[model samples]
Target: MNEIISGEKILVTGGAGFIGSNLCEVLLDSNNTVVCLDNFATGKQENIAPFLKHPKFSFIQGDIRNLEDCLLATKNVDYVLHQAALGSVPRSIKNPITTNEVNISGFLNMLVASRDHHIKRFVYAASSSTYGDSQALPKVEENIGKPLSPYAVTKLVNELYADVFFKTYGLETIGLRYFNVFGKRQDPNGAYAAVIPKFVKQFMQLESPIINGDGTFSRDFTYIDNVVQANLKSLVASSTSVNNVYNIAFGDRNTLNDLVVYLKEYLAIYKPSIEKVPVIYGSERVGDIPHSHASIQKAKKYLNYQPEFSLQKGLQEAVDWYWKNL
Candidate 1:
């Protein structure tokens, strides 16, 4: 087993985004020397603003699509948490070429850089969307289907590249197939904003929330803290866990309709009028999967994974953050 030690140099690509920023904060708190590389495309400096002055923190404003930048960021780094990419199915459907350049090309650049830098381990964010078109109730890593969208294709490609890198270059890599991750710091103003934060913001402003696909589409909705924990664990897990992919999600599912009800109930404390607001249903979204659940046994066995937050508890904490910030 490889133990993650204090004072190790770590480079976190996309470290200014929601999940990346949380991971940066955790690593910095644990006494790791952290370098954050981001282009500010979807990531905001405000997310990592507090860490700017920390002694062990460094920020490099650069894009991973640029090979020089990737190489420079990997210098003397012990580990890489590659999180930079364009996310969202609708966004990918609208402009797939751009998504490919960032997710696939950019990822390849990072892999090459990490291999050359001799980094001990590489952990990148893979997506549950990779299980596209598979009708299985709980998705497992070994059983996957044809990708349904450009975004799915990009993520599936990530797993493929990671596998090849391990076999051909002897680089240790782990891919985390994240389900619907949501929590504080998730952007609520974007056109392709995720459902949880988007709905929380709308309901806070007394606006009716929209439900795609008749509100029956369900998701595992893993919280951000669990994701941060998974990343840390992946970096420090035993050699037996290396060169593999794991499903990083809470083993539960909730329909969109159920999510709306939960959000309304939580928001009612701040806005009692929200209890009366109705949700509007629309046609199913293209590139949207009907249901998503993950079989997390592999992660549990290999990484000693133990998720501590449930949907309700996470949602309440997220709602409180929005109430104060938004």
Candidate 2:
């Protein structure tokens, strides 16, 4: 078993959310004391309920938008994993101001708090949506294009602030540009839910799933476990790993049609009728890129990252989890 350094105290903002809670569990399993700070805007207490009994786990109900809460959470923390942000392109498009407040301004609060606390490292969740208008097949770290949405703009601002903090204040920050992350604990009932979990939930209920485009649009859907691994690795990664950005993805792409077939097959065990349900097609979402695939070369070389699950394998595990939990 891989273990976090002894006596290390860690703070995870948004630690009650899908990705944050998973990271908290892994860190606790690795023998680290964890403080989970969340306002529950998008997070749920049930996600972290299993860890409430653990001696090393603590939960603080707080929002990142508040400087006092951020400071309190950062006190004596060795590492800061900033996952508290309002995600979803449509949500941002609908309400850019609130999204900016949480994703951009809130991120600044955490960065300032972390720097003040003298934290060892600050790792944050960036997004592949930052690739924006770029028409490249596989996005590399160095190449980027104009942001297509307010959400992408905010994420790009996060990277910029992280870089400035490192250069101006000597803070060690690493940004993980996640590409369509999905898996267990991801909310499937919401209006802005990611495709996989949403589809699984609809299929489980024998509802027609909707595809945003002609089902030709593809994405590099990464599993949650891989994202957790990237967070852990980025924390204690070599000194050379700081002040960098890495694409945390499976490196493969899957179209919505392929995903539908896989989901139907997996869900047939629980709801046998779902196999016959066909997915409905809709117009392409505004501000959405046509294709997105990431080059993991940088993460592979610098972070020693090795993705353990392929799309099919990950989908199977995710479907089973949704079936059992939902």
Candidate 3:
């Protein structure tokens, strides 16, 4: 396994968002100088607030959509972890044009800037949505079905772009196809908020959380720390690991009902009344698959990636954080 010990100056685009901020925090703690580029569109200011005065950490208030900003951010950087994108399937369904402009076009801008600047490696955030309509039990890297939504299309295009960048410009790249990641600092108030944090918030407030479908739908819910490990490993992995996408997950699946049980169990510790909180059922979301599981074997064999947090372990940590923070 490769570890980022110190001394590398890395640029993390979208470093104000949940995942990006976590990456920034870890890098800084490892004594690596970090430049965070974010427009605060979907990213929160509070997420990056603590790093404001750190000597080794710098913030660039910019959008990836602009080639100039991407060029500026990648300058003199050893590596680029590109996490800037408009996420959420429903958000893409509602405003695909903006999603395309940000996720696809913005991704291209970052690629060009990284290539031009001669960055050592570019590790980017790919999505499990790229699996699309495939019915595979544990989604492998090569077997992908057609994209089901604009968000999925954008992520798939990112893989294509990264592949071309590596082949055409010799810009080494690794894409991490993240599963349904959840953990601390994840916003739970938005319309497109992730199920885990959203439910935690609802339960904290003694409000009923709505579960789409009959609660049989399942997903490979990865923890943020696991994702952070994957990103750091991608940064330092050998040449053989570059130019390929790996599924970053815990290699397990759980239904919505299962998730609810865990949430209620964890939160009931904070407030015993939360145990009786009712869950409402609603229609299944469009662009949603019935089940999602990941094959992390490739990641382990190639990058020596080993995830430490299971869904239950991560949920306990998340519930604790939300209990104190929210």
| Best candidate, TM-score | 3
User: TM-score of each candidate?
Assistant: 0.98, 0.98, 0.99
lDDT of 1 by residue, 172-212 (tens): 99999999999989999989999999999999888988898
Ranked by lDDT, top first = 3, 1, 2
For this target, which candidate reaches the highest lDDT against the unseen true structure?
A: 3
Model 3 off-target regions past 4 Å? none
Candidate 1 residue spans exceeding 4 A from truth:
1-5
RMSD of every prediction: 1.5, 1.1, 0.8
Go through the candidates in order and give each one's C-alpha lDDT.
Answer: 0.93, 0.92, 0.95
What's the lDDT for residue 49 in model 2? Answer: 98
Residue 159 accuracy (lDDT) in model 3: 98
Q: Model 3's lDDT to the true fold?
A: 0.95
The weakest ten consecutive residues by lDDT in model 2 span 1-10
Ranking 1 against 3 by lDDT, winner? 3
Cα deviation of 242 in candidate 1 (Å)? 0.9
